[model samples]
Target: EPEVTQTPSHQVTQMGQEVILRCVPISNHLYFYWYRQILGQKVEFLVSFYNNEISEKSEIFDDQFSVERPDGSNFTLKIRSTKLEDSAMYFCASSVGRSSYEQYFGPGTRLTVT
Candidate 1:
């Protein structure tokens, strides 16, 4: 089975800097999502996208955060300005449908802000 893949397994950046986390989900999946897990905290949803537009977004996804399907296969999360609180393991997930059971997650990109 095909799986989601992420680049730069770990990333370190200065506070207030911009960061773009990339992922390539299973080719056939239609829905994509961005989630983050803070140290010792449960996973939290950031946003969900479908048909090249945002379907839903959490309060945590503020003006600073944006999601885009830049091309046919790439989905990306851009943090316009990072903060210490943004440091977490960011996961990219996709599903054939909107059901939770169909979702598949990537290894994750660990973002550490200084």
Candidate 2:
């Protein structure tokens, strides 16, 4: 199994704005990723595009957010404009199987609807 970590377990935001959470995943993993959870909802894979070109991404991965494979170990997603619905649990995850495809999730997305 892989290791994962997320920052600011909880976050509060206004009606319209932007927020970027952070995560640190297993050091030896190959694939890095992000996901989100709408309170009391199922976990959704926002994006899974890899190798710096987005191998895959969800419809939710709209213009509002952009992701980057900045380096060998860090992957980041930035949101340009955040609406009240943007509030959700943001999770960072990692996987070793480029083919096996098993993902381990960080704490989670808890974006409050304000």
Candidate 3:
């Protein structure tokens, strides 16, 4: 079975540094999304991409953040400048394109900014 995978399960960075958290989403899926959870808050959707274009994005996806499909199997999120508030667990999810289908989540990448 194929699944999403994220790198550097944990990362420590100074506020102001750039961080590129990587994810390889399952192939044969048409939708990809990025979400984040601040230690205790609800998971917030950042953006959704499909067919090589952004399908939707939330306010949290500000100018400092961007995503790309670098190759056939890799999806990446880049934070231009990290802030203390940026500390959170970033999750990459994929679905079979249905409200009833469960979106599979990666273990997650925990980013910490000081």
* lDDT against true structure, model 2: 0.74
Task: Give model 1's TM-score versus the native structure.
Answer: 0.97
Report the candidate with higher TM-score, 1 versus 3: 1
Query: What is the C-alpha local distance difference test score of candidate 1?
Result: 0.96
For model 2, the run of ten residues with the poorest summed lDDT? 105-114
Candidate 3 residues 16-76, lDDT tens each? 9999999888887778889999999999999988888789999999999999998988888
TM-score of decoy 3 = 0.94
lDDT of 2 at 90: 90
Q: Which stretches of candidate 3 lie over 4 Å from their true place?
A: none
Q: Rate the local accuracy (lDDT) of all candidates.
A: 0.96, 0.74, 0.90
Query: Mind giving the per-residue lDDT tens digits that candidate 1 earns over 1-114?
Result: 799999879999999999999999999999999999999999999999999999999999999999999999999999999999999999999999985557899999999999
**Candidate with best lDDT:** 1
Tens digit of lDDT per residue, candidate 2, span 21-66? 6666677666777888777888888877455677778899998888
Quote each prediction's TM-score. 0.97, 0.82, 0.94
